[model samples]
Target: MPKDYSLLSELADIFKGKAVPAKAEPGEVAIINLVDMTPLGIAYEALRTFAADTKTLSPYLLEAGDVLVASKGTQHKVAVFEGQEFPVVASANITVLRPKEGTNGHYLKFFLDSEEGRRQLKAADHGRAVMNINTKELSSIKIPNIQPVKQSYMAQRYVQGLADYKRKLARANQEWEKIQADIERQLFL
Candidate 1:
């Protein structure tokens, strides 16, 4: 199948994350720091929270369908923010990608996490003590121009597949444990 490529800038609003230095005591807002990024997704429960004044954070506050990409790291993990109970914002070491209406944020994340997508993003890597991806490079990166509906469908399947895989892996582990227990019992007998 022929693939169409579109610049990321054409599909999303690319911008850097906020640089709030200190977190207020008894934090009121959650920050998606680079440390919170994982291979699967952002660790919402483990995010650093700060008692930020909402008014000042309004611009940087993440929307429900916004996508996040770790900017300063060897692996630029990507995730779609599904919104949180408390207001959430991206940290300095992260980049916030607000998808245009034509693009699906989940699909964008799925593509960015794909092997080909990672290769494209690696072009932005400037070798140094710590690797970094600038907004300009990210904006210029080309993305597969799949229609929004198709992207949505693909994203759903990708998410469902991950869930199914995790469930099966856990069940396999349980089965293995049971077999191991029986083997130990037989050996003792």
Candidate 2:
């Protein structure tokens, strides 16, 4: 039998409030937007803007473990911030959900991306043509009940995979640079 999951509202008491107001400007930190978000997760390569002073932007500053869901545009793109780096900012189209203490952010993120979670998002979706999720509807969505340990394990695996891919790309670039250097030397010699 599957474990029972509860409506996100049940966990509302966990989150203190919505995102904080920005006290700085853009470029102060990495900014996440709907364009930057992809089904696979945050598309780091797609990220185009940064907040110079995150303090100036309201609801843009992000902390570790914050789940960013696209509030506007096409539904289904969601991303989670694991806090690997600091000074990250979220876009207005992205609503940030901070799980209550004790709950695993990775767990919540996975649950949100699951089939059931997507169904709820589709159901709560409003607007006739555009389709969007208001904060109230987003907060009321349901999340699956999974063991925190399992959540951590899965999250770690995903993180490691991404890291490995990044490292491989870096090595490939270095090899290409060497090839280019050799060609340049031969051409001049």
Candidate 3:
């Protein structure tokens, strides 16, 4: 048996990001942009931390289960934000979806990463120069009401799969490096 849900907004608190500066200064909170989210996950290498009053950013601050959505970009990517080194919030171009009680953020993340979810996001993207999906549009997107146990199981599988893939990718890169070194030695020495 399956349950039907009208839209994602019903299950979560859908909101847009705040205005962020072009650059961050020292002693400021770290902000997440669309560029920070990659296919692998959130890349913390090029973080931008700028000084902003806590009062202004406190509302936008991300919780551990909060999900970040790319509102303005070529790709529609979604990531679940667990706590990082410092306080982090999504930029104006990203949409934040904080799951309501009885909902799993990781499960929602996996669902939003699915093909159907991408299609919904694509349909909502309405911008002249860049693709954009606003809070209203995101909220209006339909979703299935999956059971809690199943959702958790699915989310766990997704996490495990991602970990396995990363391990394999690292191994492949190491092997390729070794092969390149061997070739270099054969040609030079």
Candidate 4:
């Protein structure tokens, strides 16, 4: 099928994350440091809470649908910020991409996770020790200008498929363990 495309900047607001250095306190908002980010999503287990007041970090605070992309290290690494009980924000080295009305956050993430998307992003990487992607370059990246209904359909299936795969994998592991146990019992007998 023929596909339409547009510059990412046209469909979303792309900006760098905050640089607050304070560690999160017990009950404050969680801070999504570069260390907390993963290839496909944010590592909630690795997130550190911010110690400062939420007001001080208001602008950097993330909403549930925001997409966070790495500006340093692995350039195309991205994560979706699914809001939790506590609030969250991205670190300075990451970029927060908030989709506008025309764009879908999940679809954007899926595209960025694709091989073509990674290739384009990596091709734009620059710097010595640590590679980086600036907002200018990141914004210029092309994305599919798909219809909202279509985008939503694809995104939902992609998410559901992942959940189904994980469920099947867990069931398979349980079956394997049962087989192993049965074999051991038979051998002992």
Candidate 5:
């Protein structure tokens, strides 16, 4: 461990997600699964739902600034749960990390997504059949001990840049679709 780095356990409370039974109908609780997570971010549309009383699943219920890291998988995806209007919880495959008040949750997610952070996580992987990083190993991962304010500022800048890029990508995709439609019409004519 580097002198400047601190173990993630020192900064956050780690909790393994509970498996929730699924429901056929649209339900009150949203499940954040591995499929819901992506390199860009969590795919809100990919989230599955289950019927459950929030009171019973209180421990799994996501709070604002909670970081959800994939426990079992090759990617070991990391995402921040920004707290929704309704109830949401991570699925069994995810390990929820609740950073302390002074720690920036987004910064933790960003760090875990970085090359150095990914290397640490990869080194921690030990499961045989299904590659996984256990809670204990994840808790021991090292991260730079940065002030919350500074972490927040840096995270916000990265977020803003990403959002801007996404907007431009969407616009470009729309233009490409329009061109495709024009070509199809010309072929038919």
Candidate 6:
């Protein structure tokens, strides 16, 4: 039999104070936009350039396995960061949730994207036209308990699949470009 994971609220008490950093401009740090995120994962250019003066920005830095939740915009957009050189400077409308001890980032992300999680978000949300959940509410949101090892495995598999898909897509695009180039050469010459 599988172990019963505790409610997300059970683990909330262990987290420290939430951090809300200043927004990052172009060329400062890699930025994650709504368009850059998908159900499976984030897009290649999801992390774009930041402004030169972004160093002055607040605690907007993200680690390899940090969880990024869409705070102000659409209800369901969320993403997790993979390893990269520059840290991610997320948008103001987004909330970055860093897991505390005993909580796994991958498990939190997957749980939040689930049907139960969506319902909880919907219930916690205020505002009539544009539904939104603040950092406080988001922090209070419940998540199921999962083993850290299992979470790591799930994250690894998801990332691997996405990476493979991106590589294949890149190869296909290159092939198409070459075919187009050949046709243009024959026609022009």
Among these predictions, the greatest lDDT belongs to 5
Give TM-scores for every candidate, taking all chains together and pairing residue i with residue i: 0.84, 0.68, 0.91, 0.82, 0.92, 0.71
Worst 10 residues of 1 by lDDT: 20-29
Error of 4 at 68 (Å): 1.2
| lDDT tens readout by residue for model 6, 110-177 | 78888888887777677677757655666667665567787778878877887899899899999999
Report the C-alpha lDDT of model 4 over 1-189, residue by residue, as the tens digit: 438788989888887888776643556777788778765467887777657778977788888778888888744477778878887878888889998996778888888888878877776677667878767888899987788899889878977887788799899999999999999999989
User: What RMSD, rounded to one decimal, does every model reach?
Assistant: 2.9, 5.1, 1.8, 3.0, 2.0, 4.3
Error of 6 at 184 (Å): 7.1
Comparison by lDDT, 2 against 6, better one: 2
Candidate 2's residue-wise lDDT over 26-66, tens digit each? 45356676777765567765544444544564445566777
> Worst 10-residue stretch by lDDT in candidate 6?
12-21
Q: Which candidate achieves the best TM-score against the true structure?
A: 5
In model 2, the number of clashes is 16
Give candidate 2's whole-model lDDT: 0.67
Better of 1 and 2 by lDDT: 1
As a TM-score, model 5 comes out at 0.92
Worst 10 residues of 4 by lDDT: 20-29
In candidate 5 the C-alpha lDDT for residue 61 amounts to 88
lDDT scores for all predictions?
0.84, 0.67, 0.84, 0.80, 0.85, 0.66
Model 3 TM-score, 2 decimals: 0.91
Instruction: Give the TM-score (vs. native) of candidate 4.
Output: 0.82
Judging by TM-score, tell me the better candidate of 2 and 4. 4
Question: Between candidates 3 and 5, which one is better according to lDDT?
Answer: 5
Error of 1 at 117 (Å): 1.7
